[model samples]
Every structure is written in structure tokens, then in C-alpha cells.
Target: MINHILDHRYELLEHIGGGGMADVYRAHDQLLDRYVAVKILHSQFSNDEEFIEKFRGEAQGAAKLSHPNIVNIYDVGKENNNHYIIMEYVAGQTLKDLIQSAGKLSVSESLRIALEIAEALEHAHANNLVHCDIKPHNILVTPTGRIKVTDFGIARAVTSSTMTYSGTIVGSVHYFSPEQAKGGAISAKSDIYSLGVVLYEMLTGQLPFTGETPISIALKHLQEEPVSVRKLNPTIPLIVEAIVLKAMEKDPNNRFANSTEMIRDIKRAESGLLHGDRQNNAISNQDPFATQILPRVSDSLPSRKSNLAPDEKIPQTNLLKSKKFLWGLVCILILGFFAGAFLSYGKFWSNAEVIVPDVVGKQMTIAKQMLETKNLRVNIAETYDADVPAGEVVSQYPAAGTTVKEQRLVTVYISKGGEALEMPDVHGLTKVAAETKLKNMGLKLGKVEEEYSNEAAGTVLNQTPRSGTKITKGSAVDLVISKGPKSRKVTLPDFSGSTLNSIETQLKSLNLKAGTVTEVTSSKPAGTILDQTPAAGTDIAEGSSVDFSIAKTEKATDKNTNKNSGKDASKDTNKDTAKNSKPADAPKDTK
Candidate 1:
């Protein structure tokens, strides 16, 4: 797809990267005149409705988040089946690459990168969004050491129910939370857990958990605890290790409450390091088995030491009675506790159980009625489905046959049909503006053709499929762009040897004009053209000016002087003849 343009705005320049879900490319934004990253969903997933939803979800969710450490999303669109997202192009390497090259990062660098990632998460969580997928592959680090957390492909909005279905794992197994491994509900703390794993990797140069298979690794996340960061790298401070541990706690409640809290802790750790405060790092330097003095015990029982010195058996009966009374009290408390637990268990067990009816492919209204008839509550969710008709049930929870207690909430997903919108008019707008509008409306730019028209150049003259036509998302719309009015060319002809007036008339007929005319004395007749500025046979635009040189006659005074000189010579000859003949004969004798 290189060289292909998406939405007529982003032109794919080169393949930059690829993952299981999409291929990333460096693209040029024609409208903005800037470079951007374009991620196009793999063709295999393009037709899958579930994948399409998730791909679109990434754009929708990430677009709402704005932070310096979070890559910015500029646009989202599809051309035919190719779904794409335009984002800020980060010219750097992935965190994974950094780890591989360096084997591990310094303590300070790791904390700095982690802190930036946490801040990004803080922003996303504040907007009520959870980034389900956070891993080194998604983290980009610039040459200047700025961190960018990107790839919210599996991100979803925070809601009352955000549980992952059983057997469905959405993120990288090694970096996901324990709750995510168990397909439990996800929250902002999940992102914190993933970030913690990333920090561990940065400090240790290896993943916290590894196995031959994904399932095995996921099980490790659920059942095992990772080795402390300090164990792998002794240079890591105790407080920094503690931060990683807290963020990676198995239970979400045990982890950082949110990214904000995590950020605060990270900042405090950085401060401790910067100030050379050994208190936080002193734990590793302390002696584990150091001895300490104990306080002295005081004598009780009314100076019993001296009074009962002869020892003896004076209070044996009283002591036995007290011991028996204590045992009796313990037994009574145990019995009471069991009784309460039994009663509570029986109360819960007494609720009637009902089978969930099959509602997949049923109309939403009918499905609701059916579930209500079974005394079950319905929780509805809507999603785009190209194969399923609108309002039809796509799937139901609990397998539609599992026994559930009365009043149990059964979530039913309803189809919203194929995503579509009415095409909008883009005529008369510049190419860039037209593409931007179409992309925002979920349309793709199709083949662009240029034609000469009275409209301004680069302006859109017309569009295919017309406005108001309902088109599905990712559908392409062709456009005819204006190249301005057609130009007329004129071939200059030889004007030499032609009269000046005649040349002017010819020029006017040819839509050409005569420029400055210079007069020159030549043998040719007056008013005759001598030379032309553009020579001859030159192609020029219509109405262009052409310079020229014209011939003119010599001055009349010069001809009059030559005639007078000839007459003077003739008179001189006549005088000589008269003197030679004596009046005619006298002049002959003298000769």
C-alpha cells in the first residue's frame, strides 16, 4: 500500500513497522504538510467485525487523550476495507529495542521513562479511559529521551462492567495484570500493573515471567510472584523496587490507586535519589540479624516473689478454675460463629435458580421480554456488526443455558448494523479541506482525477456518489479536482520584411500585441519591419507582447548637397572651355 493515499490527505510513504493487528507507515499529510504515522488494520482483520470495532475503538479512545507523552491522533478513516489512523509520527525506537541494545537501562533513566509513562496514564484515566494494552512494544523513546506511550488498540472506556470474557486475553501476556490474566474486570490500575512490568524489564533486562506458551506465562502472572528488581540488579534502590512491587500487586486494590498516586511516588523516589538521601536506599545496607536489648519484666501479684517464695501450691485450685473458664468461653464463641455462617449460607442458597434462554440473533425487544419472563434482568450493549441486522442480538452472556440465580444481570449485545453515514458535499473546497471533512465524517478518499475548469486550481469541482447518499464506513468517494481554466498557446510567425502597420494588424488578429518599435536607416523601404524580439517560430501565451525594429528612409538634406556639388563641377568645366577658345576660337589657340 505504499504510495497510496488515505482520505486524499495522508499519502503513505514507506513501511515503518507492523504488528499482528496492523501495519504502520510513515505518511505525508498533504493538507497539513507534515509527516504522520499511519496505522492500517491488517487485511485479515478488516472483514472481521470484532476486530474492526477494536481497531476503531483505539482511534476513538486515544483521540480523547492529549498528553505530551501520548502520541496524538490526527484522523481516523477507512478506504474500502482498509481502516487507518493518522497519528503523530515519533522518530525514535521502541522501548523494547532500547532494552535489547543496552541489556538494561540505568536506574535514573528507567525511573524517568516510567514516570513519563505513568503521567500519560494519569491523563488517560482522568478522562475515564483505560489503556488495556501497555507494553514495551507500545512505548516509544525519542533520541532526546522523551517517552511516548502509544498503541491503545485494546483500550476501552471506563464503565461499570469492563470485564474480559473468559478465554479471551487482550494484551501482551507478560505485561498484563493478574486480574487481566484471569479475565477479570479491568481498571486504571491494570495500566499501572503493565507499567510496573515495563519498569521491571527496564531495570532487569528481562521479563518478570516467561514460559514456553502464552497460557503458561499468563498462569504465572495469576499464580506466581516475580523476583524483586534488586535481586536481578543490586544497584536498584529499595524505594524504587518497592514502587515496582506496589504497582504490580496481584490485586488491583493492592496496587497504586491510580496513575496519579503512582506518579507521586515516582517523583518522590526521584527526589530521594537526587538529594542523595540514603534513608530510602539504606534498607539493603542494614544488618538483617542485628541484636537488640529487651526491656525488663516487672514483678506482679502483690510482691509474689517474696510472699509466695516458699513456693507453693497455694493458688493451684484458683488457677485451674480460671483456665477452665477461659476454654469454655472460647468454645461458646466458635459455636456462635458457625451458627451465623450456616444461617447466612442457607439464606443465599434458598433463592430460586433459572436457565438463561437463548437470545443470540433475536431482536433486542424480544430478547429483553424473553429474559424478563424468566425473571432475569437484562443489561444491553450496542456494537457495530456488518453481518448482523440492527437491533438483533449478537451474543448473550452465560451461554444462554447456564443456571443463574434470580435477578442476575445477563448482558446482551445488540447489533447497530454496519457503520454508515450520509455523504457530505465537498465541492468548491480545496483538496486538503475536502479530504479533512470527509475523513472526519468516516469516509475515505477514492481515486482523485484532475480536470480543467473555471473553478480555482486545487478546488474540488465535483464528487462521486453525490451528497446525502448513505455510505458505509471505509467506503471510498471519488473526486474531480479543478486544474483551473485551459490555457491557449500562440506560435509566433516571422514579421521581418513586413510593413509596421501590416504587422500590427496581424498581431491584433492573433491575440498578440506589438511592443516598443525601434526605427533604423536601412536599404529597405520606410515602414518596413527589420527584426522581431522573439525571432520567429517561438511559442508564447496568447496576448503576449512582441518587440520589433522597423526600416526608415535616409535624410533629404544629404541628397540635396550631392546634387549641388555635381552642378558646381559642370560649371567649372564650362569656364575652362570658354577660356581655351577665343570666346570659342581664342580658347583653342591658348590650348
Candidate 2:
């Protein structure tokens, strides 16, 4: 499994992490040449056709959703016996890990994470999808403090069915909504309840409810009210605690209606907590997205689904019971027709115009509501934006505060966030040159690895997200650069007890050199080699030099010894002659 390449594309590199359901591995996508996290469903569940189909459906739908706080799903497939999902490879620690290490987080920090999670939920809920599981384990926090939610729908399909089949609640008992605990129908509010549990854990460093067994803990969710987060962690703000308690209400109806409502209240809590506002309930602080009933059709003509023109003559009525009844029906239809015409004409002339409020920076949901509130129709056009969040309008045609007739179309260019771009060709460029190109294209250099290649030294031989591949801006491109041909090497050969000329020949044979030949007279034969540097069997660069020393031959040592002996003998002879002549005459003997 470690080296298995799924679909002949994703090369499994190493197992990184996983939860109870899947074994996650870090893989390299050969087609795109990028790092991806591949989550393969465990074999235990492979035979469950119901679970597999549900998992596949959920993955498909989740893949369609794009949010800053949600980990992106790239692909999902079944390769033979393996069911796998390739997703955004986020380099971060799990929120659970962070909580374990930090114990309890600060008030502001907790809200920040919770708010982001809520935003993500709102996005998914808007698409009519619920993230059944919302816990610290499924949440990831980047080093930069950016929060991302993962396992959006996979957990939902797995837990719901697995619980049914096994009659055992799994890992998420601590965060279970009471309704979920009861095996009742679940909705977005159920997720809100789970989020409350997550928030409670974040603030208190422990689950709000716990018991000896999963079922018991689940029962606590169904029957027990958690200790106020404030009680567990006194530092938690009153508003924050209230928000948590409201979300974790036993009845789903008792919780925030949806992600939007929860987000609204969470924002209020955050503001009150941050500013220390006296009015902790700031739900009505301001809503960017506000709307009113606006005509879906043009204001010029009264909106009517029927094809019948307002001026068209009334058709003969069907008589029921008597002629008097038919005549009465005729009169009623004529009068009603005239009344509708007059009312539409009068209302068109009398209806007031509301200024198109500034909703450029507001979320699309809020902006649409604001437009509808003004009796204006929103016409959206999507484009990429880097400075603004996705779903925010880049610009409005009628502009802010512009007076327009009711039902007027406000052409809003909404942002879908940064547009993905095709990676450019950077092969054959030097390391510095390639990096410069990537930076210019709003990309970053990922990993830089060197390998021996025929390509020029330091030139890029290949790049991940190969040229012309569409990828989001700021995506790192791993590169493979050539370190030129591998360095040439030669092994040192033993040259001990070998003549200088002979050793030089041997070094040449090995594509090496004899560095220096030192001759000295010793018991070891001269020119027969005493020792050689780089002792033997050592690998070094081809043509590298090896130093050597050789002992002098015994014959040469003997010749020098005899010369010294002869000189000493001559000195002794002179001394003897001088001594013998000294008795006769000291001056004559010295001469």
C-alpha cells in the first residue's frame, strides 16, 4: 500500500494521518505533479455497498463547494478495491492537537476559530448540505491561524449508516446533537449543535458531556444540559457562553435556525466580547445582506406567470347551476379585470424608489437581500478577485445609493476568489531564474531537489503542475533540477611495495595520479613503495591524486655507510701519527 500508485497517477508516498474511517496518505499526482492528500476508505467498509455509494455521492457534492475555510476535494474515485478521495494537502496541525497542547484557548482565539467554522458551514448549508460532524478533529488550523474544515460529507455518510449497522455510536459522541443521539432526523441545526460542543471544548479544554461509554455519552447529549461553558472556564464571556448554550440546546428548534443565524449571533458575541459592550446581544448590530420582497419580473409590466395579456378580453365563464350565476360570474370577471389593471397602473405610478445601498464589500447572500429589500433585482456575474472574499461583489452597476425603479437589475460582478492560472513553462531555466518566473506569475517555489541528469547543471529538468496546468495562485510548484552528469569517480588501488614507475603506471590505469614520490633509505626496499595515501579501495573523483612514500634500497644505504667509515678512519690515522711524533718535537709532529 505504501508504494501503490492509484489510477496510475497518484503515487502513494507515505502515510501521514487518518481518522477511524480512512487511512490518509501523502501522494504525488503524476498527471498534475502536485502533492495531494489521498484518503482511502478502509477495507472493512469496502464491502458495504450502501456506505460506498453514499460516500461517493457526498464526495461529488462536496467537491462542488468552494470556500476558504473548507479543504478542497480534487478528485474521488474507486481504483479496484480501494475507494479514495484526493484532497487539498493542507500543511497544518489538527485543532484537536492544538487544543491538547494549549489546553484551553483564549476567548478571542476560540471565537475566531468558531466564527470561521460557522462561515464554512453557512457556505455548505446554503447548498443544502450539512457537515454532520463538526469537532476539533475535523478542523485544521494553519500555522498562520487560518482554519480549514475537512471531511465535510464523508463523515456524515459514514457515521449515520455505520451507527445504524453496528448499533454503536463512534468517535463523535462528545459533539453529538441530541437529535443525532436520538437517531432522529438531522439538519443544519444539528451541525450548529455539534459546533457548540466544539466551542465548549475549545473554551474549557474538555468535552461538555462525557460518560464511561459512547452510548452513555450520547445519552447525555439527549438528556443532559452541559455545564455552562462559563462555569467550566470562568474567563469565557457571558455572551460567548450564551451562544454556546443556545447552539447546544436539546431540541434542534431551540438552537440557532441555521448557519446564518448562528453566524450572526456568533458575530455579535465576538463583538461584545472584544469591545466589552454592555449590550451582549448585538444580533441586530448591522446586517449587510438584507432584503425585501422584490418582483422577479420586470417592473414595466406587472409580473404574471400566465401568458394572457392584461388587455386581452375575458373568456366566457363556465355556467354552474343557473343563468343568473353565469351572469354574476361574467360581471365579477369584468370588474376584477378592470380592478387589476387600474391597481397595476396606479401602483406603478405611485410606488417609491429606494436607493441601491452599498453592498460591494458585503457577502452575496446579504447583498442579495439588501437588493431585494430595495425592490431591485440582482443580476450576478462572476469573476476572480484576489483582494476580496469569494461571494462578495466586486462592483455594482447601479452603484451605491443610486436611485432606481423597483425591480431594476443591478449588475453585480461577484468574486469567485482568485482565478486559477495555468502554470508556465520554467523548464531549462536556472534555479534562480525559475523562481523569478514563478514569483512573477503569482506562484511560489515548493520543493527544490537536484538529480544527476544530462541537462545542463543547475537547470530545471521538470516542474510540478506541469506547464499549462490550471492551478490557483500561490500554489507551490515542486521542481526537479539537473545537477549535471554524476561526478566521475575512481577507486584507489593499493601500491605498497611497488616501484615509483610501476605505481605511476597503475594510477594511470585507474584514471588516477601518483602525487609525490619520497625516497628514503630504510629496511623497507627503496623504489619498492612503503605506503601510499588514500590507502586502497577508497572511491574518489576520477583523476584525483594519491600521495606515496618509498623506502631507499639497502645497497644505497650501505654505500653511504662505507663512505662515512672511510672518513673516520682517515681522522684516526692522523691522530695516531701526531701522537707518535709528539715525543720528538711537538711543532714537527703537528706539521
The weakest ten consecutive residues by lDDT in model 1 span 157-166
Give the per-residue Cα lDDT of candidate 2 at 479.
97
Model 2 residue 447 distance off true place after TM-score fit, in angstroms: 59
Candidate lDDT scores, in order, read 0.80, 0.80
Q: What is candidate 1's lDDT per residue for 1-591, written digit by digit as tens?
A: 899888888889999998766789999999989999998877865666755665577568778788999999877888988888888999989999999999999999999999999989888888877778899999999989899988764444211112312124445778888776655567889899999999999999999999644555765787789998999999887778889999999988888888888887788678768876554344224534211122345633355546665746555467556978889888999988866654322223447888889999976546767887887777666766657876578898867898877767788887766676788999889999999998897778999999999889999998988998887766788999999888788899998889877776889889999888889989899889999988799998887899988887778999999999999999998988776755533445555
lDDT of 2 by residue, 390-424 (tens): 55678988789877666667777767666678889
- What TM-score would you give candidate 1 relative to the actual structure? 0.49
Per-model tally of clashing residue pairs: 9, 10
